[model samples]
Target: MDSFKHMHEWRQNIDRFFGESFWNEFDSILKPNIPQINIYRKDYEILCVINIPGIQQIKQIRCEIDGYHLRLQGEIELPAKGYELIQEEIIQGSFNRAIELPYRCREDKVHARYEHGLVFVKLYKDVHDSNKSKTISIEEGEQ
Candidate 1:
């Protein structure tokens, strides 16, 4: 109860001090995690859909699967051979995005295919035994 009041007062003070403009300026420094993801879960497996447009080479992308999360890091390099630039708006550098997978995926069984500038990665996960839980018998001994 006391903690809630303190938290409320703290939030009100922060809101009064910074307002909206201060928050916008602070948001400009840190890029928000943005991605178009569609997830589907079936009885057998889960499907994850991602759209990574404006990418040149699929080989430049690095993907890693850890537990139930997928870590993706890559850079979209600017194209050198092309027409002269009139208005350059798109940024060129490095970017990384992570997605929490519904299930664990096998590393070697993962397959990736690129077509029409879209990458489709197929991951296979070995089903685990979901029927057991560790139970520790505790006995309190007087010290």
Candidate 2:
């Protein structure tokens, strides 16, 4: 049909204009490329739990919170002498994950703990009032 051909041509033109990036982003958002996260909502706070295995050391991971987004960037080094794997599905290499957090966290109260090869970060809901105020002790003639 001529109408079907016109629709196909229009679709191709749109795709050509946007390139593959538009589709890729749409795919990423439609079906996120990361592991699933579980949200536990209590009366006062929202908790996000991610199952990140094989990640050790809280210091090795970098966490940054900006507005509603929280990002975690880190590396998990594989063992040097693991037997030649025929089939490997475990995800390796450095991963950078950006998660949109449901609630604001206290920037100073964000804490991380590692146990059983999993890294867990607890973000508190309330920002500490003390963190907002900066005390500058001006020493006489120190400048």
lDDT (10s digit) by residue, model 1, range 13-83: 88899884665766535654433456677774655555555665656666665546666666755666677
Candidate 2 lDDT tens digits, 1-143: 69999998887888899984666767666655443356666754555555555554555566665545567667766575668867755556676877777766555555455555554555667543332411111111111
Return the TM-score for candidate 2, rounded to 2 decimals.
0.59
Clashing pairs in 2: none
Report lDDT (Cα) of residue 73, candidate 2.
69
Runs in model 2 lying further than 4 Å from the true structure: 1-18, 25-36, 80-82, 126-143
Instruction: Please provide TM-scores, in order, for all candidate models, with all chains considered together.
Output: 0.52, 0.59
Q: After superposition on all CA atoms, how large is the RMSD of candidate 2?
A: 11.2
Model 2 worst lDDT run, 10 consecutive residues: 134-143
Against the true structure, whose TM-score is highest?
Answer: 2
